[model samples]
Target: MLLINGKVLIHNGEGLNFVKADIRINSSTIKELGEKLTPLPDEECIDLNGDYVLPGMVNSHYHSYTNILKGTSFGEPLEMWSLDTVALGRILGEREMALSVSLGICDMLRSGVTACLDHIPHLATSHIAAKTYKNTGFKSAIAPMLHNVSDREILYEINEIYPVNGKHNKFPSVKDYVDYYIDFINRFHDPKGNVKVILGINSPQRANDELMKAASELACRFNLSIHCHLLETRWQRLSADNDISPLFKLDKFGLLKEQTSLAHCIWMNEDELDLIAERKAAVVSNPTSNAFLGSGIFPLKQYIKRNIKIALGSDGVNCGTSNNMMDILRFLLLLQRTQEMDYTQWISIEKGLQMITKNGFDVLGFDKPFGEIKPNHSADLAIIDKNSFLDILDDSFLNQMVFNASISAKHVLIDGRFVMKDGKISVIDEEGLRREISAIKPYLGKNMRKALNIANEEKKIYKSVYESLLISPSNIQ
Candidate 1:
């Protein structure tokens, strides 16, 4: 495949520059780059017609399980929202799981995101989602959320506030979950397929020491990245039992390392930030979700100043409400501007571009070179119609992209294959997925309604307990 006559952004580690060039691809890897390449016989040629080509953006953190549950909750903080969405959203069968994951990836492809780290809470149907990605030719790192706490236990903790009686579902033992993750890794880790597994600890508050140590050992043996949530809410930080910070505990267990990527570090203090930077760990911020769930703003300037590798994520469709990285970038840029008073403290458009691209590659530890367009790199790229939003002869493309929230990809290529062309997905069954989702709508609705009723009954008790804990409504609203 040969792509010609495109304005390409070349980032060669030092800086970014624009060049009019042609790219040659052999199978899945980029083969050559120059002004005008003589095409070989039978080579598929595509004329970009002066369109703009950029490396596909990477979503460092995401959740496909809630892809089917958008707009289900409103005006609730992360804690309360999870009670309604995530707790209830897990009630999905294999077929529903497959369709939902496919739809999520389709949305991502349309928005020019070619890679992601999908943090799945339910282990039962994660393989089904993985299968959908494999068939659709998308890249992902699937990390099943590992936590020892059972739903019944959580309900009990909430019940202390209001009185409700119910039996909790039986959960697998700690060893059982660990063995399942190892089995999942052995079965699904494939570099050629562009899909792999990572170790996941939902949070230190939910996972026990045994599970954390076991996950650390397994990740070391396999040399995989460990994904975790760190201080997303002030309530979460206050709820810690001991005086020790969660980062300290994680570090003590050898889980805090260069390969680990922490998500939503919204409530980290100065000391925690310093420790993370010292450990050379990476952080991913979900600006839209943090704002939607009323979680506090992440200290973007602090991370940048400390030299902590930062990446951006959309979080989940249910919370962030969109898979579009363009929108996420806009929100991130604006939020950073509003949070810091110093004009120089805000993130620049050039730096923001790297956060979604090259910085993400470093956080995810992808074996192949990606997040940049160059010779011998994976041919994962997005083509945007320059005329769609920009005026003729206007070279301020970065400013237009960062300030506008409606920009989308005209075509997307994953590993040299056209996953989306002419603004439509070509590699997956888009219509079939739509039909399946429509067919299952009533059943999912019925199940979720029942779950919501149960949540409401329990919320009465949970709310009073929340008040007793003195959790500010703004924190979890």
Candidate 2:
């Protein structure tokens, strides 16, 4: 395949710059690049027609279960939000799970995202979701969530958040989950293919030491990348016993490694920050979700100065409101400047692009030739229409693209195959998928109603206990 006459964005050692060139792809890798490359006999040709071609964005942290639940909550903290949504995920049937994964895949492709880390909550439905990704031509790391703690355990002090009256829910045993995850990995993980089944530990607060150690063992056993959420809230930071942070606890469990990727380290202190950087572990920052939940600024500048490997993610549509990596890039750039008065301290457009592309490849531990347009690199590219209204504002195409974020890919290629073209997904019937998605509402609603009932009953009991803790005369003294 040959891509001709496109403004190709390349990382020229220092920063991302563009050059009018053509790309020749052999099999799934780029074979050659230059101006007016002659196509070999029987090679297919795609004319970009002066459009901008870029490396497809990577979403290093995402939750597919929440994709179907977008716009359902507003003004809720991460604690309250998790009680409603993660619990609701327990009732989703196989069909509903498949639809949710498909919705997320289509959204990512439309936003020029070629690959993602799907931090899934349910393991039973992962195969269904994995099959959907294969059929849709999307690359993914399907991570089954691991945790031993229950909601009651996490919110023991504020159990009012839990509903008092509801049907009892029994979670799968740790052994049962581990067996399922091993089977899922053996059945789907392909070293030579684009899909992989990774491991996920929910968090230090939610997962016990035994479960965390076992998760680490599984990751090392399978050589798969492991991801877990860490320290996204100030309350979590304050609640750590004896002033030992969650990161320290995770490290103590032997889970911190080069392949480990921690999400949303917003409240991490200097020691935790230094620990992650020293271990060469990756950190995925979800700027929009952090801001939406008021989790606090992520200290992006600090991470950069420490040389910690950093990547960007949309979190999930439910929290971030969109799967567009460019939108996250814009938010990441602007949010830092708002806090730092020094112009040199703010995140540059180049660094933001690197996070979404190059550092993202590092997050998954993929050694494949990717995140660049040079020779031998994977032919994962997004062709953007450069004639948008925002193009006139700046000569730097990257600056305009990140700042405006109003452009979509005119065509997208994953592994040298066109999965989307002319703003339409070519691998599936998108409209038919949209119609099928409507069936999921009743399932989601059923679980949500049950959750709300439980919350209402527990609220009064929890409030009484909580008020005593706050206003008791002995407590005051």
Candidate 3:
């Protein structure tokens, strides 16, 4: 296949340049990109008609299952937000989880994201999203994450603005969490390509020494990359294990190798920052989610200075508020400038554009010849609306993409195949998924209503116990 006659917005280091380029896709890679390319006799030619071509957006952190938790958790801080989610998750089943993932995938595809790292729980239903990614032409890193913490003191703040909840679970040991990893990869990982079962830990608060150690061993044994949420909130940073940062402790436990990825280090200090740069562990930034949830500004400038690999993610439509990578890039640009009170030294339009394309691929360890459009690179292209940037050209393309571009990606391709076009899913039947999704709501909610009713009754009894305690304290006084 040859994509001929396109105004390619080649994201060159200096700036985005408009070049009259023709891309020849031979199988899963770009055969050539130059002035004139000879096409094979049997090759299919796609005339972009001078449409703008850029690399597809990559999301390093995403929660596909959290899409269903929307509207209910609004205005709550991170702590309350997650507590609300815990209540919601108790009601969710396989079907609801699958529907939420489908909705997340569809939104992400339309929002110009071709690749994503879905940090999902080890649920049978969540695996449907992983399966969908494998069958479609989208790139992905699916980590079946688990949390097993025995103490509340070790747990970090779950959300930015929310207070840490007291200890509520102590049943599952860290060793038990490790045991689940073996089966998780066996069932979900596709060694052929497309899907990879990256071992992911949910958070430091829910993890223990044994769990962290086992994760390190598995990653080393299988050569699988690691993904985990670490040192995100202030409470997590100033927890009982104050000896070091979460990344530092992970490294000390032999978990912070080059293959590891930590999400939303919003509270990282200088020493911790240095360690991440030294270890070469990737940082997945969720700027919008952090900002929206009142999570402090992440150290983007410092990361850029140290040349640490940084990637972008929506975290999930629920946490992130949307599946728009363009919006993330836009927010990041203003965020860095305002945080530092100056932008000239740390970040720029070029860097923001790179985050969506090249930098994102780097986080998944695929940048060199996969993220960018060059000879022999994988043909993962994002076709943007030419009219969207007509008012800006040359250096302005970078400005437009970072500030003015729409979140809707328009069309996307991975491995030289079109997964989405004109905001429609090309690989899956949207109508069928919609029908399945509609049936799921009533089914799961009905069961949830029953469970809630039982909980309500139990709570009534529990309330009496609380009242008795209050009166008993008065009588003792």
**Could you tell which candidate, 1 or 2, scores higher by lDDT?**
1
Model 2 lDDT, full chain set: 0.79
lDDT of 2 at 377: 79
Top-down TM-score ranking: 1, 2, 3
Query: Which model is ahead, 1 or 3, in terms of TM-score?
Result: 1
Error of 3 at 353 (Å): 1.9
Estimate TM-scores for all models: 0.93, 0.91, 0.86
In model 2, where do residues sit more than 4 Å from their true spots?
Answer: 159-169, 242-244, 389-394, 439-450, 453-477
Question: Worst 10-residue stretch by lDDT in candidate 1?
Answer: 156-165
Instruction: Put down candidate 3 lDDT per residue, 350-395, tens digits, no spaces.
Output: 6677777787776675433566787777778888766677553455
lDDT of 1 by residue, 146-221 (tens): 8875433433245243333233534567788878988888888885568888888887656767777887888888
Model 2, range 49-155, lDDT digits (tens) per residue? Answer: 88989898899999988777777667456665665566567667787777788788788888789989888887778788788877766778777888766655455
TM-score of decoy 3: 0.86
Rank candidates by lDDT, best first: 1, 2, 3
The per-prediction tally of clashing pairs is 4, 3, 4
Model 1 spans with C-alpha error above 4 angstroms: 12-14, 150-169, 241-243, 468-477
Candidate 2 vs 3: which has more lDDT: 2
